[model samples]
Target: MPLSPKPDLSIIVPLLNEQTELPDLFQTLADQKDILFELLLCDGGSTDTTRQIAVELGGENSFTTQLLDTPPGRGRQMNAGAAVARADMLLFLHADSRFEAPDTLSIALQYLTSRQSVSTHPVAARFRLHFRRRTTHPSLAFYFYEAKACLSSEDCIRGDQGYMLSRSCFEDIGRFDDSLPFLEDLRLAKTIARQGSWLLLPVRITTSARRFETEGLLRRQIVNAVIVNAVAVGWNEFFRELPGLYRCHTETGKLLLFPLLDGIRILLASFTPDQRRTFWQATGRHVAANSWQIFFWLDARHAFHSSLPPESVRLQWTNRFNRYCAPFVCSSPVAWVASAAVRLWHRAMLLLCRRLEPVTKTS
Candidate 1:
C-alpha cells in the first residue's frame, strides 16, 4: 500500500535452515497495518531450500524482500544486510523470532523517532519475548547480557536480544564486529548504547521453543551462562568444548530485562568490602574472576533505596539513578540529587578509564 514509500525501517533476519517459517512470517508482515519496510533476509549457507522459500514468500506477498548471501555467523549476516539497507532504522531479527502483534513495529518506530541520542543508551533494546513451549522460564539471556553490560561497553548486548539500530548510528560506529563468531551482538550492543540511548517498552516478541525442547531447561541454562562467561573472558573458543547436547539451541521464553541479572549482583555486593576481600580470597580460586568484575559489584545491592536496578539489564541497575529517574514515579529527593551527581562524576572519570582500558578490550 502507498507504494511502500522509501520504507520507514529495514528488518534484517539471518536465516540458517528455516524454510517452513518463512511463509508465516511473510504473511504476518502482510497483515501488519501501514507497516512499509523492506524485509532483507540474509541466508547463512542454508543447506535447505530456504532461499527458494524466501523468494516464493516475496512473490506471494507482492512486497519487496531480498535474500543476501552471507557467511554462517549471525553478525556477518546482519552486517551484510545493514550494508544494503535504505531505511533510517535497521532491525536485526532472528529467523525463528516473530513479532506477532502489528503494534510491535509501530511502537518501535515511534520510540526510535522520539529519541535524539543519549551518551549511553543502555546497550540493547528488547521487549518481553515469549517462547512457544517453555513459556514459563523467563529469559536468562537478559541477565547475561546485562551482567556483561556492566563489566564493559563491548561485552553487554548480544544478538539474541532482538537488535535494532539507526542506520546513521550504525554506520558512524561501524557495523557489528564480524571478528566475533559468537558475541558480535554483545559487542555491538554496547557500542550502540555508548553512542546513544537504548530504549525498551512492555511489548512482547514470540520466539520458537525448539531450543527448550532440545536442551532440558536447567542444564541448558548452565550452558548459556558458561558461554556468556567464556565470551566475557575472551575464552570464546573454549565454549566449543561443550558436548553435542549443547551444540544446538537451548534458549526459550520471553526475556524480562532490568531485574533478572542486575538483582543478583546487588545481592552479592551485600558483603562488606572487608567481607568481599575475605570471601573472594577464600573462594576466588574456586571461581574465576578472570575478567575481574567492577568494584561496585561488591556492594550490597539493597544497601541503596528499594528501587535500584540490579547488575544485568543495566536499565536502572545503578542504585542512585533508578530512584530519581523520571519513569519511577516517586523517589527520595536526596537520592534524586545524589544519583545525578554520581553519574556526572562517573562521566568525568570515563576519559581516564577509557585511556586506561584501551577503549574496548578491558573493563
Candidate 2:
C-alpha cells in the first residue's frame, strides 16, 4: 500500500526501552483502519532492541513510519517528533497505549476537527482512559481513578489518555516542558486548559497498568500525589534533590513510601520558618482546589453501584461544595489547617505501610 503524500494525521509516540511493548503497539497501529496517518517513533536512547524492533515491524506496517533517535526524555523526544511531522494534526500517544476500535483515531480526529471549526478557542482532545490490568477483579480504587480520568477537572486530564490536537494549536501552547525528566505531559495539560480548552474524546484508550500493579496501586498513587503536590507548590527542592523519585517503567517494584516521606520531612525541616509557612499555605490552596475529589469519590461510588457512566451522575453535594465551601477552604487559615491534617495523614500512612510491608513479604 502506498502512503499518502500528506497524511491526515501524525501520530507521535515517545519510546524508551520499550522492546517488550513494541510489538503490541505496532500491531495496534497497523490495525488502525480508515485513517491516513504517519507514525513517528521517537526513541529516547533505548538501550535495548526497541529501536531495532521498531525498524523491523515499522517496515511491515502500511503507514509512513519514521524512527528518530532523541535524548532520553519524553518531552524532548515528542518535541523532536513534532518538529519533523508532515501532518497538520498531531496525536501524542504513550507506547503502552492501545485502541480497542480500529477507527478510534479516525473518529477522534474527525471530532477534534469539527470542534475546532465551530469553537473560537484552540481545541485539543484526550481519549477516555482504561487500564488494561493483570487482574480481572473489580477494584473501587481503579474504578474511581478510571472515572476521574473522564472528567475535565484540573490535574485530572493526563498524558496516558492520548493527546490529539492540530499542529498549530500545539505550537501555540508551546512544546512540552523538558526541564524535568517527567511531568511534561501534566504541564502541557494545564497549559492547554489555561490557553484553550479540552474535549474528552468519545473513544477509550487502554494503557498497560504494569507500573501501578507492580508498585502496588495505593503506593504508586500516593507517590504520584506527592509528586503532583510538589509540582503544584513549586517545591523545586523535591525534584532537584530526588531526581530519581520517579523510576522508569521497567525498574518498578513494590514502592517504598518511607524514604519519600522522610525526604519531604527533611526538606520541610530545612526550610526557614517563613518559607515553611509559605509552602504549607501553597499546599493548602492546592489541596482545597482539589477538595472536590472527596465529593467526586462519593459520586463515583454511587455511579459504580448503579452501573452508570462516569459523567452521568452528578451528586448535589459536589455542587454544594463548589458553591458554598470551596472558597472558604482556600483561605490561609483553612489552608494551614488542611496542611496540618495532610502531614498527620502522611505520618499515619507511613506507619501503616511500615507495619504492612513485613506481612506482605511473608504472605
Candidate 3:
C-alpha cells in the first residue's frame, strides 16, 4: 500500500488523552477507500499514551502520518497540523469521529470539489452528524440537534460535524482562534459563513455522545446554551473567571448547573449599570437571531412524530420570523424584555436542577 506522493486530502485531528480512542479512529482512517489522505495527529500535551498509540497506529496505516506536539489547546493543535499539510484540501475531525461508509471521505471530497468548480465563491463542507449514543431510546433533544446540524444557521456547523475546506480557503479564513480554549469551532464556522458558503455534505459522520450521556443530556445542553450566550454577549470575564466550568468530555459526570448559574449571577452583579444594560441588550439580540430555532423545533417535532428525517418537513414559519420578526425583536426594549425572560428561565432551571440532582444521584 504505497501512499500517494501528494495526498488528495490532509485530515487533521486535534488530540488530547485519546489513547483509548486512537485504535478505533485509526481503524476508521484505514478503512477509507479510493481516497489518498495524509493523517496529521496533532497532540495537545496528552499525559496518557495518546501520542505513543498514534505513532504505533500510524505505522500500520496506508496513508502518510505525522504526529505533532503542541500546547494544550484544540485551536492551536489544529492550526499546527494544518501548517505542514501536503494536500490542497484539509479536513478537521475530532478523535471520537467515525465513518460508517468507507467512501465517506471520497464522496465528501468529490462533492466539495464539484461544488467549488461550479460556484464563483469558495465553499466549505461539514458532514451531517449522527450521535452514537449508548442507548437506543428516542430523544427529542438529540433529534432536534441532529436536525439543526443539517442547517447552515449560525453556530450550527460544529467541529463534531467534521469541517472540510481547501487549504487556500482555510488560509483566507485565518487560523482557528486560540484566544479561548472553547468556541474556536464556532468562531471559524461563523467566519467561513461570512466569507464564503457552507455546504451540508451528503455523508454522515458518527461522533460519540459521551459528554451528553455522562452529564445528563438536558443539563449539558443548558450549560452549552449558557456558554454560547456568554460568547454572544461578549462576556469575556465569565470565561476568564469560571475557566474550570467547562471540563473535558472524559472528566464530565452528573453536571451541577447551580454553581455555574450562581457564578454567572455574581459576574452580572459585578458589572456597572451601563455595562449590565449593554450585556443584556447584546444577549437579547443573540436570542432574537436564534429565534428561528423555535420554528425549526416545530419542524423537528413534526419529523420526529412522523418517523421521517429531520429535513423532511419544510416550514416557512422560520423564514417568516427571520424576515418580519427578528428586526423588531432586536430593539433595545425587546432585548430588555428578552433578558428578563432569560433571567426567569435561568431561575426555573436552577430550581429544576436542584430538585433533580438528588434523585439522579440516588438512582
Evaluated at residue 307, the lDDT of candidate 2 is 79
Candidate 3, pairs of clashing residues: none
lDDT of 3 by residue, 80-139 (tens): 999999999999999999999999999999999999999877689999888999989988
Candidate 2, superposed: residue stretches over 4 Å from native: 1-4, 350-363
Name the top lDDT candidate: 2
Candidate scoring better on TM-score of 1 and 2? 2
Q: Could you tell me which residue pairs clash in candidate 2?
A: none
Query: Which of the predicted structures, 1 or 2, would earn the higher lDDT when compared with the native?
Result: 2
Query: lDDT-based ranking, best first?
Result: 2, 3, 1
- Using TM-score as the yardstick, the better of models 2 and 3 is 2
lDDT of 3 at 339: 80
Q: TM-score winner among the candidates?
A: 2
lDDT of each: 0.57, 0.87, 0.86
Candidate 1 residues lying further than 4 Å off, grouped into runs, are 1-4, 117-124, 134-158, 236-363
Model 3 lDDT, full chain set:
0.86
- TM for every model, in the order presented, reads 0.61, 0.94, 0.93
